[model samples]
Target: MTTSEQLHLPAGSTGRGNYETIIDPGAREGWVHTGLRVLALAPGGSEVVTANGVEAMVVPLNGACDVAVGGEDHHLRGREDVFASATDVLYVPVGSQLTISSKDGGRFALATAVATGSHPVALIRAEDVPVEIRGGGNMTRKVRNFGTVGAFDQMDSLIACEVITPGGNWSSYPAHKHDETVDDGDHQESELEEIYYYEIQDGPSGPGFGFHQTTSSGEDKPIDVLSEVRTGDTVLVPHGWHGPCAAAPGHDMYYLNVMAGPDPVRAWNITDHPDQTWVRGTWESAGIDPRLEGEAR
Candidate 1:
């Protein structure tokens, strides 16, 4: 992972609300790859937009909203309600206009990714699919097979899941990189890009943030980026030693990570930094983040 893979937005980059606009492909300045942007909506105005060359999925973190994708309208209320015990996934192809409006307006999170070709969009409900925890650490993750699930199959599409990392524990620790596709005795070979949209819990005012670092190929041109991120702030992980370090201050931090590679195959392939790869085998000795003891609202 190199510093060129990371993209950080200063304060007030996105609109208001709990939503922090991470990477707006339409508004991005430098670097060109498939882009991703996240919005944390508050209780007020509705978020309505037409998808141009992008495929999107609406996942609610705290509250619910009425989502309309590709002229089809569906009401997503809660996590358990939207994603049934059977299947909880939604697929929206490119060229579809997604209009999200909330009557009561609570905490609604939207993750949009740039599409390569034409792919039809569809809605996924949690109750429709089987829910299982493929992996766990400081955070417990639930995998809902949307694209691979036989029913909703599209060429070069999106993979969505819910990750709940416990407070104080490192969720994306031992930072890894997936910018390139390589077969080191894992499985087949494929290329895919990824994005990290973060949501952190703050004190009465706000919680202290975290830092992200990326190393270039050569040591002389190394890049060290340190930014204080809040609830709606997003960090772009194109490639590099990407880690979300939660400081001791307010509450726990939650981030919805959206990833898509060039290859049609949907899988997670990561390579850790040689210097820090040892940390992957030491989570058992560490305790949960003590700072997360604060009230969770």
Candidate 2:
């Protein structure tokens, strides 16, 4: 009963079938009826063959990497500081044998979920967890908590967050929806089930742009995806009205929003698409994404 497919890997583009390069998602193919899978690692080195079943998570979007998982080995570095929590979300367990290495290169964002019944835990990274900004002046958002916020209990299925919408401003602006129900009045519900995963900022001769929108449950039905994203592009929000409009006129737009669902309660309910719901009161006055001046890799 879940339908919405758009998986585009435009950066070298590897082998497999439906847009290949999958480091093993239980042999792919609609990935076990959408158990959730995302991989676009290709920089200097890569090796992740979870050949027993599935249960993986090694996220990093630019520079530094060295994970061995199961056999033990973790190290993810790269940050100008914007809520830094690069890499190390490994939880491979299903005959586990995950391996990854990058000697000063970049690009590595992998997220897999499929443990037959479920049982695989091991995460390491114990310090320097700072990157917070939740609603303040234009609803400014730049959170980065990286794993273990109750470890797999925001709906028990693994969750992740890394949002940064600084350019022309607007990060998920109003237009929201978590499938059917969860969170009401100012929205605050749970039923987890999401995935934004995007990256842009190549302008100034680099070429990178962005634009995303979805709506088709009435409410003026609209689905415009004005595309032009860089660094292993990906945009999927199984539900509806997902927003990402950081028009890179100068450069400053990053997205890394991964969510899980089944309703165990992790809180984050949204439902505002009645004509954009008045653009969330026009963000008070709108101001903050003025190219977000340096800092935050």
Candidate 3:
């Protein structure tokens, strides 16, 4: 059994023993179905990333880039940073060759998954994304549903999105899980493996950090993870109820969620923890947190 300490991947630890950090599907034991890679380049830098057996997306974290996929070129109007604005995205099907180049180089995230079907290359613009404000009170947060199940449904197995939690706020709350295939009338839960890639916004003086936890949902498969995550850190959730990602005071928190599973139907059906189910009912009275404004509205 892998310990929680093992699941907490610090920046540069999984750099494929080089200058680049790449977390392939099989990097961690029992984690053999999802992929994420962070690429950093200098000015006028370019790299060719091959999606030999998986479906992938080229997302610019900071600065613009040109992505050449399947004989077509797609230019992404990227943002200054994750905290600045929502950026454009490019999707590449399995067995495709992708060339990512930037005139003024920056960081990029290559999110991939074990593709179940082949789809055409598509470019998802930043302006076209549906920005949503989910939860309320201190639970308020911004969610960019760029590639999730209901927002943009074109992929075969992968589901991806970005979230921003204001300073001192809590998001991904009430603990939830989707680790079982259940069909109860209209309600259904899909068994999925998830990854949390974090980027804590720096304060005026120094760096920042946040806390995350994942516990078993009283199931046969035992799992536990509690970590203090910083920028470039990642946590893997094989099967458990994850929640309450807390952003420390004076520093906002940002994360990119990548998910995929064995279900034939692509969906994100989750079951919240029974004890915390009452939290949802109190949002109406508590009202939404005021700090969540501007970009998401």
Alpha-carbon RMSD of each model: 5.7, 17.3, 1.5
Segments in model 3 whose C-alpha atoms lie over 4 Å from true places = 17-19, 294-297
Clashing pairs in 3: none
lDDT of each: 0.53, 0.52, 0.86
Number of colliding residue pairs in each model: 31, 6, 0
lDDT (tens digit, per residue) of candidate 3 on 199-279: 999998899999988888765777778889999998888888898799998889999999988888888999988888789
TM-score on alpha carbons, each prediction: 0.72, 0.31, 0.96
Model 1 poorest 10 in a row by lDDT: 288-297
TM-score (C-alpha) between model 3 and the true structure: 0.96
The CA lDDT at 136 in model 3 is: 82
Number of the candidate with higher TM-score, 1 or 2? 1
Q: What is the lDDT of candidate 2?
A: 0.52
Name the TM-score of candidate 2: 0.31
Q: List runs of model 2 lying over 4 Å from the truth.
A: 1-56, 63-66, 72-101, 105-156, 159-174, 177-202, 205-244, 250-252, 260-262, 265-270, 277-297
Deviation of model 3 at 50, angstroms:
0.8
> For residues 181-292, could you state the per-residue lDDT of candidate 2 as single tens digits?
5444665645444555566666666766666555554444333444555544555555556664454545556666666555544445566667767755654466433333
Total backbone collisions, model 3: 0
Arrange candidates by TM-score, descending: 3, 1, 2
Best-fitting candidate, scored by TM-score = 3
